[model samples]
Target chain A: MLENKDLLGIKNLSPFEILSIIHTAEKMKLRINNKKLRENTLENYNMVTLFYENSTRTKMSFTMAGKYTGARVTDLGVATSSVNKGESLVDTGVTLDQMGFDIMVIRHSMTGTANLLARNVNASVINAGDGINEHPTQALLDLFTIYEKKKNFKDLKVAIIGDIAHSRVARSNIFGLKKLGAEVVVCGPATLIDKNIECLGAKVTTDLKEALKDADVVMGLRIQLERQKGGLFPDLREYSQIFGVNKDLMKYAKEDAILLHPGPVNRGVELSTDIIDGEQSLINEQVKNGVAVRMAIIDLLIERRKKDEVTNTKWSASESFIQDRWEKRYTG
Target chain B: MAAAKGGFTTICCMPNTNPVVDNEILVEYIKMKAEREAVVNVLPIGSITKGQKGEELSNIGLMAQAGICAISEDGKSVENAGLLKKAMKYASMFNLPVFSHCEDMSLVGGGVMNAGEMAQRIGMKGISADSEEVIVARDIILARSTGVKLHICHISTEGSVQLIREAKLRGEKVTAEVCPHHFSLTDEAVEGYDANTKMNPPLRAKKDVESIKKALKDNIIEIIATDHAPHHIDEKNCEYDKAAFGIVGLETALALGITHLVEEDIISPLELIEKMSTNPAKLLGIDKGSLEVGKVADITIVDPNEEYLIDANSFVSKSKNTPFNGHKVKGKVKYTIVAGKIVVDNGELMD
Candidate 1:
């Protein structure tokens, strides 16, 4: 069982916890297709999706995951809410917590937003994404997809190419893969990569060929075009020719090597159209696994919450009973 | 006043407040108010720019005559070089020191903490060391050209230390101050995303902390002033990016210095006192640092051997925003006497 009340990042989870989450996700994936088995797993649970940044895949996945488990899910659209009128993140979180939200799935543009919210409220926070910080659920799904195919993480060479600095997916993946005993290498443009990323235990390289050489799993991060305005790269053409994952780059990897991209792929920017839709591409599978992983996370957290409540009730009952005996003895 | 409870007999108030204290009327008002109600001496430092808008100069000449100790464009640097040079020249003529808050706003970008491995790991924008160094270099050059008494406030980066050291070596009328946070904490403290750990010139790397200690030891950086900014709990208890900059430093400043500096043997207790008291008074040209015969009795009595954990809740300041909560520290303030009056008696404030 997960020991922490919140799933803020993969960095805080141990190797044992990583495998436990993945194993639980495997069971969830099997039950997800069978409506009868999936229904009522999380009955009476209320989940809220609070996204500060625009998202389609992550938001939809969490919503679907909650619905499949028979939990009431509400999408708190940031644009239409009081947040638009300048309600602070804490105020918004506390309001939702007061409304009896059991879990809050949050994505924000600032790093550590989920951690901040988790500290402020009683609800379990599941980080969808936070600025350049980890997107725990996204990485969990990617791990689920990889584990399904490879059946093991030991000795796997995972090459994550493109925008390693701004991509929270890459940060979460590097942290998760390293704990699973995989050799992770992050490749991107010099300006697109951060100087201190190697401290996370990932080998950083500018050479795409060096990163892709005999890789078991190859992941491509979406390069935000706005980064060009900041002069992180010159243009898409240069980025595509040098760093874009295409058929030519795939030749450097093993014949059966799989590919992954945290979707809405900027086709032709981070990955070529052929590679994104290729036989080895698990991009679509990643989306399916996202729902399963989220279900597993929500279910496990609710289970823990239930156990904690029972333990608290028992402890309080025994304390009151002892106090009653002391009071009677003194009075008599 | 909370300053009295913090063991400070005198504190130079920064001008970056509501309405921006720039004119003679405000300076006289502060002086009159302190005289009537304050238990501690309050010296008001007027702003370099009129509104701290950095567009034009304030009433430097008139404010100085009205008993202003210095002029500062603290909380930010005067972005305009020519305007700052002109301001520095006027300050020099008035015999008033320019306490510069060195920071290049353009270089800060959107950074909230020191730009390094820790910031990168957490995925927050970083404030590069050059953001501070470039301004430190610029101010030093301006001070040398204008011949004004330049006291750099809260020197954080190693590069800034090197710049100040070089300036002092050349005998430029340049001096600097380092806050307790700069010497004691590093960027690693920001890893937890606590807003209390967040402050301007954000806690730098370990090497910068080492350089700051060495600077104090060698008298390169001669003063220790608390950039004591207090804010409401609502302003601090939020997301790190949206939270306000600065922590309550007045209460914790002395204990942190004694524990981090004196106890570590980086500098002697006497040297710490000189940095905290003697040097700051000398920089401001005040007659109050030492307890000589016939001198005013502005003194802070400290039990250097007493050790205790810092509790932010126990702080007398309105805002309890401090990163050093529960931090085991050596030394405690036993008494604080200002001008022969017992203000802080046995660590408790007297009515």
Candidate 2:
């Protein structure tokens, strides 16, 4: 059973919790392969996808997963909803909770928006993305992809490249991968690297070549071009030349290094175009696994909630029964 | 109700109220309400901006004439430096100090807690201490250029304490205040994502807490003010980021000092009173905070030996949002005397 009511971040999850999600995803992936993924496992329940930020892939993936599980899914359009009418995120969440929504899938541009929603609502909260804080579902899918390829995470060297500071994908991956015994090395331009990234139990480096040496899995983060005016980096040309992943630089890897990127990839900026379509690329597979992982998560959380209700009813009924007996004894 | 219950003889109310004490009428109305209903003296503070919008200046001279003790844009920092300088100049002419909430909004970004290892661990957006320091440095320069009496509110970072110390050394007319939370708690308290731990200039690092205590002891931070903000249940009983910033501090400030500062030998009891009472009274030019033959009697007597758990449910204030709830604390207020009238006698209001 999943012990947590919400999937807020990867940092709070134990190795056991991470493994449970991965193990469940593996079973769900097989069902998808055989066209047996769609089921009535979650009938009569309502799930809402509240995307405060624009997302195409993650939002669609979550909707598909909910539909396949037989749950009533409502995707709240932020621009068209009360959110644009100045309703606070918490108020929107509470309104959904009162409407009997069983789960909330939220994506917001603020770091702690998911954390805030989880506290205010009675329904389970699954964070899609929250500012530069965490994207836990994305990390879980990445983990499932890595585990499918490598079969084990112990002593696996993983290289995370490009904009390390603003990428919530990098932050979640570092925590989840490291918790599962992977040695994470984050390589980027000095300005793009956070000062406290090393304290997250990851090795920080400026040289991409050194980071790729003997790497089992390589992840590239999307470089936000808008950050240039804010002095996050000098320019894209300088960034691509130094940090870009080309075949020539890939020679430092162990000949079996797999490349992963949380797209939409800056084709020539973060990685070479050929590498994205290369035999070693797991980017497409990561997207395919994303659906299965999300199904596993929702299934687990819904099951836990049902069990808790049963336990609560049993205890409360027993208390009433004992009280009734005491009252009858006194009256007689 | 809270100030009196906490054994305070007088309180300087911040300008960030619902209507916002930005005009002369609101300032006068606050004073009138306090006089009619309050057991303790209430000194209303006027806003530096109209509606605290940071766009235009408030009627500072008129509000000063209406008996406002000071002017501030407390909840948010004045983003415009030129406007802040002008406000300080006008405030200086009236001899009213400007209480600045020093913060650079761009630097703070979307951070919810201190930008440090803890923020990294939890994957929360970290508000770097640089955000506070940049504004502290800027406001001090403005104070020096305008020659105004400037007081920095809620000093939370070590960098801020250092800047204030260096500014004082350079003979800038600047003073600073530290909240009890800044001196006692660190950003680690936010690990649980508790709404009570959520406050503006959110709880900083352990080193920052250490620096604040040392600064208080060294007299770099001259006062201890609660910044005692209160919000309704619906406002604070939510997620850390969704919750309003601030804890109800009026009732817990003295107990925190007695427990953390006095018992730990960080400051003597008398020095604690100086920061909490004497220094603040002197800064506001109030004729209280001491026992003198010719002065108005504003005194708080406490049983420093008493130990009790901080129960927010028992607080006189309507808001029960405080991270210090259930915390073991020393000292209990026994009596509060205002103008030689025992308002709070033996922990009960005398009416």
Candidate 3:
């Protein structure tokens, strides 16, 4: 029972909360696979996807999740909505809330837009993605896929390679994995690596091949071309030669190691396209789990919001109990 | 009223106001209003470029004659070097110090916070230390040639401090100020995406914060002006990138100086006053910032031992935008007196 109404980032989520979401997602995935309709827990609830930035994967998945749960879903097209007429995010959120929306799922290029919008609305705000900040649902889905394979976080080694400075995926994964008693290795060039990232309980290395050694999971992040011009790294050819994952580099990892990427994959850039399509690849599985993970988050948030309304408190009793246990384990 | 309530006897108002303080008329209007309504003296800063558009020079000579103390393109840099060089030359003739908000627009394109790990973590655009250093270097070069009394505003980065230090060593007639927020806070403050933490030359990295503190101690930075910008609720209560680039500072300036500098043993108590008061008054050529026997009796008696949580709702300014709102701080202004009149008594404004 997670207390938070908004799933802004894994950094804010407890390990218990992480497990809670993963377990719920597992059930959702099993039901969906068996051709069972999702429980109509969200009937009469309305959800609006307010995307200030373009995204096909996240938007569609969230919409499908809402519709799957028997909720009314609306997509506010950024180009055509009143948002294009210079409406602030808070104004847009307030307007949607006033129109009786029970939840607003937002994706904005500006970091912290979800949290800012959350403060202004009565509805539960879910972050689809914000600038280079956290994408909680994406992290959750990735976590679900990893937990399915590894079964536990104890003694697990997760290596995240490429664009660590600019990848929201890398940040959330590093925070989430570290909290669950796993060792996270963040590998990138010196410029591409964030300074003091090791302080977040991750080991940072410039040598990707060395970092991949004995790792249980390897996650590759897309390198935006604009970052190259900023001199974070050399041209594409040099980046692929240095940091890109290939068949030769796969020999360094564990025999049963899984590869993960939050894509549309940058073929031959972050990874050789063959690896992305290989047996070791969990990229497609990650995508499939995205729907179930989103469904779990939507369900949890809606449940928590309804419970809090009845209790007239920020968090209900059972939520506070699990939150305390998770927090104590995390800190001590 | 806000300045006096914050224990400031005099303030050099920046040029980037609603209708920018460009010409003589606006300068006169500011002087008239301050005289009529303000509890403290207000020195209007005329824009270096007309409308602060960085084009031709504003009416610097005329505005200076109308008692404008300084010429500044405060928020926006005078990007055109030739135009700025000419403005510096003209400003020099009137002995009006040019306060530069040093920034390269190209380098700062759409950046919202200090370019560091925190910005990387949050996924916001980073304004690099080079952004401020580049302009500091350019303006120092210009000031070297033009011989204007150049004052750099809200100096944040270590590189900018080094630039000003070397410039001062060469006696290039350059002086700089550090905001309390810059020396005390870092890019880490932006972790929560609080818009109150957002300001122009945004809160810098830890190294930069350390450098700013060191610079102030060594007198490389002469003053600690707030660059106190006030914005309405709507302007700041938005996304990190969309919020206005400023924080209200006058109210918190003295406490921050005492807390971070004096209490931390980085600088002595008298040095804090020199940076906050004595030197600022001297640089502006004002008859304030002192309480000599025959002086105007403008003074602020601070408790220095009082500790309180900073609540923005208690701010005398109409705007409640401040990152320090919940910060526990020492040193409260017990009373503020100006021209032998107590404007702020016992931490409350005198009606």
Model 2 / residue B241 / CA error / Å: 3.8
Q: How high is the lDDT of residue B29 in model 3?
A: 93
The candidate that achieves the highest DockQ relative to the unseen native structure: 1
Question: How do these models rank on TM-score, best leading?
Answer: 1, 2, 3
**Candidate with more favorable, higher DockQ: 1 or 2:** 1
Q: lDDT by residue for model 2 over A285-327, one digit each (tens)?
A: 9888999899889989888779878865332233233223323
Question: lDDT, candidate 3, residue B246?
Answer: 92
Q: Best candidate, lDDT-wise?
A: 1
Clashing pairs in 2: none
Which of 2 and 3 is the better model by DockQ? 3
Q: Give the TM-score of candidate 1.
A: 0.94
DockQ for all models = 0.42, 0.34, 0.35
Per-residue alpha-carbon lDDT of model 1 for A1-332, expressed as tens digits?
88777898999999888888899988888887776676676779999999899999999999999988889999999999999999999889989989999899999999988987887677888999998889999999999999999999999999999998888999999899999999999999998887788898999899999999999999998888899988779999999999998998898999989999998899888899998999999999999899999989998888877887876633222323322322332333
**What tens digits encode model 1's per-residue C-alpha lDDT throughout B1-351?**
678777889999999999899999999989998899999999999999999998888999999999899999889999999999999999999899999898898888789999998898788888999999998999999999999999999999999999988888898889899999999999998877877788997999999999999998898988999999997766776778888999889888889999999989989989999998899899999998998999999988989898898876677787777888878988888788989999899998888
What's the lDDT for residue A151 in model 3?
93
Listed per model, the TM-scores of chain A against the true chain A are: 0.93, 0.93, 0.92
lDDT ranking of the models: 1, 2, 3
DockQ rank order: 1, 3, 2
CA lDDT of each prediction against the hidden true structure: 0.89, 0.87, 0.86
